[model samples]
Target: MNELLKVNYDSDRITLSARELHEFLGVKTKYKDWFPRMCEYGFSENVDYRLVAQKRATNNPKNPYTEFNDHEITLDMAKEIAMIQRSEKGKQIRQYFLELERKWNSPEAVMNRALEYSRKQVQALLQTNEKLELENKIKDQQLNELKPKADYYDQILQSKSLVLISQIAKDYGYGAPTMNKKLHELGVQYKQGGQWLLYSKYQNKGYTHSRTINITRSDGRSDVRMQTEWTQKGRLFLYELLRKNGILPIIEQN
Candidate 1:
């Protein structure tokens, strides 16, 4: 067998035997037909005979093989071969041959190295996915815990009691104007009589209801009566009343 036909069992460098190299280069002719042409063209006597023969056989017959084999392989030829072998479309073909060569002739260390690299990449991707899943679960749990309190606050704001609105705001830590702004958004209405009265449209159809609240002073001598009616200014006043009394709940807004 030719020296070029012998495989190196230790080298990691990609290599090809003379016959194999010829096949890779796509030479259609036989080695016997090509070796003499290389010699006639001044290929070195020391040149790998099989490689030279394959090259000669593959040369276009129209352009007879006159180029010297003794000439060093140019950088352009090396680049051309690399481009063809390493292209995206050629990845599978190159990897298949490379793995086969590694399995057959390379050391066990090389195979182990490749396997270790692949394992590390898989482990990293799994860890990242797990962390994202854990964060999403925590966010969902937090939302579940706060939803009921928020709903309760909404119900209170939508109720038809000025006293209750003020109490809720004070309990929940909302300022008067802020609480009133929220009430207005919910379409609740307020009216001023002796004091402020808040009402909901659904509770008092046709805006006619006599939901009255009376405030008695601490001296036990002064009494105040407030009647409910629907108006924007009344609602604002009711908000002020609730805020001044410190009755807004902090839970409703958040």
Candidate 2:
């Protein structure tokens, strides 16, 4: 709650500027002279302190910009140096650092840090999910842009091959009854007494043919029936007609 001296808690370590510490403690000796004397107390470089650059004004018109060496000493080193000072300001700064360290390592502080880490992970996951959703949307848009062209190619290739009504229905993810019903609704064909036949307008388009089948009824009476089958042209016609009405085979669906 009170500021005694500036403390740096960056670089994954708690540290203090040695020069700032000297000025705060009101040391009468020059920093260049005082710091060397402090180092004589068996303190090690990079372990007890790290060398850092401190910019300075040379106070000369010829070379105004210059630099001086400084050190960022760990809190433990700073506490020891304060004790070595054996002065009123040194005692105050040392006690301030002790209290700060106690609070920094408290259980409440640790839990807060863990919660902050969890929040960061959740944010990262949400960002990743958003990216994937955008990618899928783009893919769907590209597929929709190309669907009509792909369906045209499919019709060209498939219509060249003879196929059964049930097989064609299967390709569209439906059954014969559904296909027949759809074709009937579109005026492409009609159901007669016992079979489906092309409408009069489409009958002479070379799209279909009727085959006569001889079968024995369950009563052992012989009967003849007409089975109408589609040609490749008829299948292609159906494809274009269905596509115009916004019905598509499974292959052409998004």
lDDT of 1 at 205: 41
| Model 1, CA-based lDDT | 0.48
* Candidate 2 clash pair list: none
- Model 1: CA > 4 A from native: 1-102, 105-114, 137-163, 172-187, 195-249, 252-254
lDDT of each: 0.48, 0.85
Kindly list the per-residue Cα lDDT of model 2 for residues 85-153, writing each as its tens digit: 999999999999899888778899778767877988899999999999999999999998788668766
Write down the TM-score for model 2.
0.45
TM-score of every model?
0.34, 0.45
Positional deviation of residue 103's Cα in model 2 after best superposition, in angstroms: 1.5
lDDT of 1 by residue, 1-254 (tens): 12322243332233344344344445556645643453454434333222332334436778765443322222222223323545552443344454555465557767776777788889998999899999889998888766755665455457664344444456556665565566655555443543334464445444323454566688886665644444333443444455466543344343
